[model samples]
Target: MKGRTVVLDHIQGREAAALMVDGILEDFLIASDAPPIGTIYRARADRPVKGQGGMFLTTPDGPAFLRQVKGLAPGVQLLVQVTGFAEPGKALPVTNRILFKSRYAIVTPDAPGLNISRSIRDEDERDRLLEIAHDQMQGCDYGLILRSCCHGADDADIAEDVSAMRAQAEQVMLDPGTEPETLCDGDAPHVLAWRDWTDPAEVATAAGSFETHGVLDALDVASGIVEPLPAGASLFIQPTRALVAVDVNTGSDTSLAAGTKANFACAKALPRALRVRGLGGQITLDLAPMPKKDRKGFESALRSAFKTDLDETILAGWTPLGHFELQRKRGRVPLAEVLK
Candidate 1:
């Protein structure tokens, strides 16, 4: 309970994964009815929405929207990968840049190159990985990326991972299907837990791990509107039709530094709150009433906190009305929406 713990379990018959740090829910994932990110499809190009600068395609699942498309005629078959979860009444988000990702490697069909993750800083280790890459991808044309997880792992395991990804990519690329169909399914929550959560942690995969490790309780709190912060502060995370509105409050304590402290507290806790609740898209933060001079400190705290976060986040600058904005990718369906 004092360290990182990964719990792989089920919630309401859907597979779920939870990452707990010191008995607190740090991240959460659950399956949904919509297509998960990374799903590959052989789709038929449909009508283009020129006004929106995107094209709608037909897939086995449903209609998907691909952005930045040009001159793609209707009825032409091409591969597309799901990039993100769809917003309400929108087409599934798909991209032409297909990537086959695993625990230790990623194969990119569009970007052709062999590279290693920059996090593996040791020169000798990089050379060793490069050697393995050369040997495995001798005649391959697709791009290959050795993930940071390859560091300190067994060479055989790394080799096998790269080989597996390359094979899958080749098979999908060579498929001669003329109709809309699925090429590959996305990794489920439990699989994502192992692939992305690379830090050393105690693993619990028992049937009742969620209940035994208190993930269920933490999830119940995360599903609510109020999220507790340090020094009796709180954040009201409310999702409106347009965006997620976060209102910060300095509860009880009214010290001169209360606003600054509460702002910093919200900065640190906001990522975890949004991650656990699976809330993303436009995020408007109405931070505590702090002095303008403290804005830099608040932004610094926010940047440092989200630096290690898994999902993509763009910290758009503060608004004219003192509100901070963030554009976060919708990686998964909302937890509340899923349960409902």
Candidate 2:
């Protein structure tokens, strides 16, 4: 709907730092302060619940499990936290929790009673997938985070991806690939396009095409493009973790608000401000911290902007910082990426 920037953080030695900024996206930056490790998620292993083995952690980014399976060996059980290692040409243990190294979670089942439990029309195909997973499991136990591509994927597709991975691992023995080299990747850019299409806010600005210079139309959030900004309407974009400040200069004729009018204007335009400025995430409006008489009007402006007609989304009360706060939904991308 609005023109925004999404900065994706990659992983570093101990932190993640990647930034994806999209101001219409033709001129975009997928900058990284570190490695492109993607997002980290918390997961709980559900099936074949083991008392001794490790628990699987599934995040939006990838799949990792904490192994304590050896505790089943009787006597005093030892709960082991295994951070898996990938070695070329080395056989994996049955107890090892080896997952596809990726930025997204795509787990499949390999252990007894933990295989894909869903019914399938083709028994042979299902058995084949399970067998493939079993073979990959090798020496010890393992868990798989099967990607979405696994859905309706023939045995060949899985075999190709998995085999490609295995072959790449073998190549590492002859000549190791660069750490930054692509090992496994997720869905294509068009899939991302489809996700943005479902949201209704992504293309809200551009009815025609994006300009050759890469400036998109003024955004309308969920609606459509409002009115296009006249040429020479300078836009200054400032981004913060919680809020984004967009200073719009309406040229010489524009008048600065004297009293409560400014607060009222801001309140009235907050929703559109969020949309056009791509200002989602945790947001707080400072508004110069106006006087008590103007406070009610400012709060009223915020209430009007929510568009949901519910009190659940807006925090109408004052805050400790003397600024009014608005808890809006986090957008697909961030503001800094767009603004930058």
Candidate 3:
């Protein structure tokens, strides 16, 4: 099993929280004030502009835009989920597709039917999960999407999680009179990190603040301290707005064989670093040149390493200059902006 640990640090004198996994800084977010992503909000359609195909909404957090409105008129109240966070001079994006996330799965109250996770490639396991979901969904109007964590879970465990999510969805659906502009907050970033990246049962909390828990040291390592790898190797991670570029550098004293070994090691470690840094979107890896025949083996190893990531990641093949390109879905806020 891959050993994982989570650390939540309340940075002194800052209005943000830092999350570390396995002693590596992964996510940092503004505490409390950040826009709640999965929170369900009761909002009223303020005015529908005929020029635009959507309507404006007035929510408790503020105004939001509904890109599509089907016969929705002004002053119409409905339940909407926070789809995206608000940007500077921009409003949050809301959608009618409501979703409730539990420990093991996501429940879509208005979805057409049940859908299983695509990451579970094992045919037998997928079929088994589908059977379990079908059993739990009986008499329930909503649908469920089994998360990655549900891969090895028993039917009873899946049933319990689904039941809890069903209850939440039911309460929201029954409360059509919920006050407008009110929201039901979802899980926090740290909680989500722990749940998705590490086992909640294995989490150990420290009594003092982050400074006392060696979180700052981890942050320092993430910031710039490149750890020495086998054969005197190091990695330089450069993150830009377009993509993250990781450069593998070997010591001058390293032999050719040792350098190639280090390159392979770097390729294996790169994915974990990306996940811990929360560096999503496009990525490019520049490694020491190796034989053309060996490239395929290296790529295959990289693919295997990335499969462990919770978010969807796509390997876009190699470039003419021997740079490896990849794309990860922007499922969460970038660590750079979060820390800034």
Candidate 4:
């Protein structure tokens, strides 16, 4: 872990990991891939349950449980977004208005009764349901997590996740069967690890160039670098195994960002993270060895670069060997499309 580092810190009966780079705290991850719940599904209407709760909508799987009016107003159709599970290991029949709770999610054959279940009810609550679905689709662009990655996230982040779910659902509605039975190819463990980056704060604050400082630039740099390569590079990228190696050599003559040149150099390197799209692992950087006085600026620059993916980046101070340690987030293999 040269440029990125992650240290586990236990807080309040739970374990919270602090991501740092060159000794700066960036992001934190509580749980990994918990499950997708409350995702909307376009389901066929099952007979309404007179009492107890709502109807059991027929999803791609089988009957999905729905609540009639949990979060709806009285006299309204009580259109609640779909929630609950169907039978496990059941392939859902693809049909019109088959079964879906909202715009965010669809009931997949995988893990129906388990987590990642989908279903939405409440006709009047369509607005809310639509909102969630829309968010789910655009969540990655907006730095929001999918419901599968939503556990222990704060309210604001959770809201982003809900939105991602909705957005994804809407896309399904607009064009059916864009993908096969599965929406996404099963992502690798590293992809889930990388998704832990992206600070909600960075998404909120900072505009334009400045706003791009945090996860945005990092992701941008990583993606840019990794996607465009001559075929058969023989380099395989993986969170559990793959990592990027960066070596910073101080120019013989100091002509770059004066005063805190070391820090400035680190700033310049920020975009490289995104260009390469490296996540959930270590990146080692050997900073151009500078005099003791130039150290402060170098430290500041390193800290600032992490704000983009602050949620998952870790910075540990220079090591005795004079190398900087950084732990970045890694995700599933970059889609073949992105590589081109």
Candidate 5:
């Protein structure tokens, strides 16, 4: 309970994975009916939206939207990858930038380069990973990204991962399919747990591990609106149709620094709260009554909190009404929707 632990289990008869750190739920992933991100598809261009610079494509799952389109003739078949989950009644988000990602390596077909992960800073380790990349990706034109998980990983395993990713990229990129098709299925939740949770931790695979490790209990709290914060502070995360509203309050704390304390706690706890709940899109934070001078510190705290999150979150700065705002990518389906 004091260390990092990963639970590969099922929730509501659906495959799910949870990462717990120091007995707290840090992240959660569950399979959903929506097409998973990272799935590659041979999409056929349907029609472009006027004045939107976007084109709609046809996929096996459903209609997908590709943004920033230019001169894509109708019926043109091209490779695209699922970028994120779609909002209700919206086209599935797809991008032309395809990436073949694995635990240790990511192969980029259009981008040609070999780069080591910036986290692996040891020169010797960097050199070793570079050597592995150079050897495995020899004569390959595709770009390779050595992930942070490559640090301290076996050379053979890293080489194998790189090779497999490169091979998959080649096979998928070279396919001559003239019609819409599903080229590659995305990695599932359990596989994602193994792939992304690279930190040293005890993996629990037995049945009902979620309950044994208190993951189910944590999830119950995550699904609710109120998220308890430090020092008797609290934040309510309510997902409305337009945006996620986070309201912070100092509960029965009659101290002079109560507002600052609650605001800081909200800043630190916001990312994990949204992540565990799989909430995304527009986010507006109504912090406790704090001085204007403390805005910079609050912004810094929020940035530091989301620095390591996998989702794409843009700290869109404060609004005219003193509320903090952000735009987060819909990387996963909302937890409530998934569970339902």
Candidate 6:
């Protein structure tokens, strides 16, 4: 397994971090603009908007909206997790279904169940993890979902992580009087990008001013420097409100075979670009035109590349116009906006 490196570069006039996996830019982190996701809070339901099918809650950080009321009346207290941050005028999005995440697993306090990660394809490992969850959760009243990182982890380590998460969940339940505010601050973007997006033996961190690293150069390329690619191909990424669009153009070489190779190369690089830029939500890839029979192979290659994404990503198949559609779970603001 290749070790992932986290480079914190303050040269951009802000606290920016990048996740480099096997020398490829996997993700970017900006500490200034976006509010951390997964922050837990205990809030009081302000009022129910019967028409909107949701209720507003008051929290220490600010107001949050619960998309579903769930029969809770005004003034009823509820424990919620910060799902999304506030937009220009929108309130933060919160959910009653709380999940406490640890280094190896996620603990769901509102439900009691066990779910292995879909990324864990090995039946034996999945079964073993399930057994561990059952044994550890014997008397516990919370749910456990092993993260992808838990694959091949020792039983003792998994047990320890579960125990710690359960303790945190217990603390939250015991102290229901927590002021309507963020009870626990979420992990930093760098922490999340490393933990969720990469596989590494160890992670190292540094502070203060530092010299430019190769990751910085990758950032420059991603920001539109037209980095060189295989077979004289160049990639362009455009971020928009609706979705991120990627265009792959072959350099001067107008041969059909060259175009096909460039398109395939783009398939391999597009996922890394999306992750590196933290460009989540809808994504459309406009690759050079290829034969209809080759579409399946191209799509398969793209799917394999996206397997490393931290959040769930669905390839919605190619459109009639030959553009590929993809949807990724929205966890934070895009890095482009954050940098701006």
Using lDDT as the measure, name the better of candidate 1 and candidate 4: 1
* Least well predicted 10-residue stretch by lDDT in candidate 2: 11-20
Ranking by TM-score: 1, 5, 6, 3, 2, 4
Candidate 4 similarity to native, TM-score:
0.33
Model 1: per-residue lDDT, tens digit, 17-121? 999999999999999998889999999999989688888999999999999988898888999999899877989999999999999999998999999999999
Taking the tens digit of each residue's C-alpha lDDT, what string does model 6 give over 5-100?
667556456666666667766677666554578888889889777789999899887788999676788888778888865555778888888888
lDDT by candidate, in order shown:
0.93, 0.38, 0.71, 0.39, 0.93, 0.75
For every model shown, the clashing-pair count is 0, 41, 0, 98, 0, 1
lDDT of 5 by residue, 1-340 (tens): 7999999999888999999999999999999988889999999999999999999999999999999999899899999999899999999999999999999999999999999989889999999999999999999899999999898999999999999999999999999888899999999999999889999999999999999999989999998899999888899999999999999989999898899999998988888999999999999998889899998999999999999999999999988998999999999999989776
Query: Once superposed on the true structure, which residue ranges of model 3 sit more than 4 Å away at CA?
Result: 1-4, 13-33, 41-97, 112-138, 145-160, 173-182, 197-201, 209-213, 225-228
In model 6, which runs have C-alpha deviations exceeding 4 angstroms? 1-3, 8-17, 46-57, 68-75, 85-87, 114-138, 151-156, 208-213, 225-228
Which model is ahead, 3 or 6, in terms of lDDT?
Answer: 6
TM-scores for all candidates?
Answer: 0.98, 0.34, 0.70, 0.33, 0.98, 0.81
Tens digits of lDDT, candidate 3, 1-340: 1234455545543343455455555444434455667778889889886877888888888888898788998888899887655544666778888888877878888785888888788999999988888888898878789987788888898889888888888888678574585557867756565446534433435644466545666665665526445666888888775678888887664565655676688877876566555566788888876777888888888888777666688999989988889887654554445555
Worst 10 residues of 3 by lDDT: 1-10
Off by over 4 Å in 1: none
* Residue pairs of candidate 3 with colliding backbone atoms: none
Q: Positional deviation of 280 in candidate 3, in angstroms? A: 1.5
lDDT of 5 at 89: 96
Cα lDDT of model 2 by residue, 152-242, tens digit: 6566656555555445333332343322222333322233333222212233222223332133332212123221224323333355644
1-340 in candidate 4: lDDT tens per residue? 2255434433233323334454333343332222122333444455555676555445443444555424422222211232211223422222222223222233332222212212223343434443443544432322221333333334455455455444654465454532122232222222323444432322222224212233333333333333221221112233323455554433344554332353355555553333234243566665555666766666677677666442356776777887667765433223122323
Question: Which model, 1 or 2, shows the larger TM-score?
Answer: 1
- Candidate 3 similarity to native, TM-score: 0.70
